[model samples]
Target: MAKTTRFATLIILMALACGCAKRSLVALVPDPDGKSGSISVSNEAGSVAISTPYRATTIESAKQQPTAPENIGKKTLDRMFAEALSIQPARPLHFLLYFENNTTLTSDSVQLLPGIMAAIKERNSTDISIIGHTDTVGSKEYNSELSSNRASTVKKLLIEQGAEADAIRTTSHGKENLLIPTGDNVNEPRNRRVEVVVR
Candidate 1:
């Protein structure tokens, strides 16, 4: 009877250990929009969801999708997947490119040039939105003019690099759409940036 009791206790302990291990490693990820969809895994893993207002069922197939490096947004999407699957989701991970300041584009910016070019190339078949903003360091009118210039500069570069002029559109927020908001006339470098959105 004592041997039987010992065996049952051991089995129970093993079962508890397995349950704890599974709970620690498993993940339940919802669809990006938190709709009626979910992915379950015994271990953490990454996934992707394309969220453009426009719909394209042909693009939904992973096999049909263009390979990475060939597609700039696709490469970023892959990075996002790797990050989401990491053991710690809270750790800083790769995100979209944000170019701040009106000075020359840096080496990092140069590296992103090709990717942007790829996106622009694809934008011919899609609608592209380019929004420009600036740090709160000048008069509203001055900042507005500066932001428009910045957006125009980017659009010019894209055009020079072979993007269709008609496919590209530009808008200036003039420090209105700040990622981080500081009081007026304060220099928040991060706010001075342009965002390119390709559908």
Candidate 2:
């Protein structure tokens, strides 16, 4: 079998040793958006795939197989991993702003800029990413430049709204990474977009 990393983005394995060695309790949890993804736990002793939210397994020893995942209550999770969960950082926030064409933001997106700015202020966000994308309606070189311009325009607007310039970064994907994929020379409004992430 191919080797795999046993890691979790939300909550990883929580071990409460009872004067025992190589024993652990692992739990799967929902992400900030209330969605849970699958994970696999394996070793030379055994392997198991777990996908259900709030499910847990007990590994008793290196030679013994991990117990089958069973549905567990949230209260149990809180009690068992209080300190670990409390220290977890708040989830990052994401915003998508659509464009009319080229570097111009649509009317709705223009209105959205202020709200994004407000969120940045409220979070006291120091890390920000602004990525630009364009529809596949032009040469790749032209679209690349257009996307770069779009990101720059958003950076300027955010700075005007009091966002710290040093905390923000910009990148352009041109028509290479489209929100709505399309054939060459096609116009896709959804593809003309700028995505912002505040952390």
Candidate 3:
């Protein structure tokens, strides 16, 4: 299979594995008077179980379909959902940085560097893709070289910011994939960009 197809397949498999893994959650909030709080779980089998604080519950599926608890307050139920949402798995992030007239980073792009670096640091595992693009302002040959240089420059910056150099893969699309399609030789800043995807 082609590399793109392989990469896409790998992503789909990872998502499926995450979705299908045996997942469990435990809720252990104390009541106001130091009494025990409770949690309830119900499965598709129409069976239900209830437990006190510190007990763990196995969520059967990604939906985590749960029936109402017997004696839980609105606030406590809201808190449960809030905490559950916060603990979901991280999703892929994309960063788009535009270039100046030629090869230099635009001011906005410079400001985005810190966010990109922080994301790299925050993730436990990193797989990065950087693709450089350019406007239709020059000959195909020259634009291709320029786009490659732009990608190289971003890769260097990422490496300098403590990213593993070997983890990054870059390609140049030149003027072929314009963010804003236009006539030839137009100076479109949006088209002159480097797209970074962190997974």
TM-scores across all candidates?
0.50, 0.84, 0.56
Q: Stretches of candidate 2 above 4 Å error?
A: 1-18
After superposition, candidate 1 runs with Cα above 4 Å error: 1-103, 122-124
Model 3 clashing-pair count? 0
* Candidate 1 lDDT tens digits, 35-133: 534322211232334333211111212333321111123232344357665654232111123455563444466577678777545434345666778
RMSD of 1: 16.6
Q: Write the per-residue lDDT of candidate 2 for residues 1-199, one digit (tens) a residue.
A: 0111132211234342255665677889898888899988877789888998877777878788887787665666777789999898777889999988767899999999888988898889999999999999989999999999999999999999899999999999999998876899998999999999998
Cα lDDT tens digits for candidate 3, 37-147: 455566664534555543333355656564322333334434547877577667778999999968899987989988998998888446899999999999999999999
When summed lDDT is taken over every stretch of 10 residues in candidate 3, the lowest stretch is 67-76
Ranking by lDDT: 2, 3, 1
Each candidate's root-mean-square deviation in Å? 16.6, 7.1, 15.6
lDDT of 2: 0.84
Global CA lDDT of candidate 1, please? Answer: 0.55
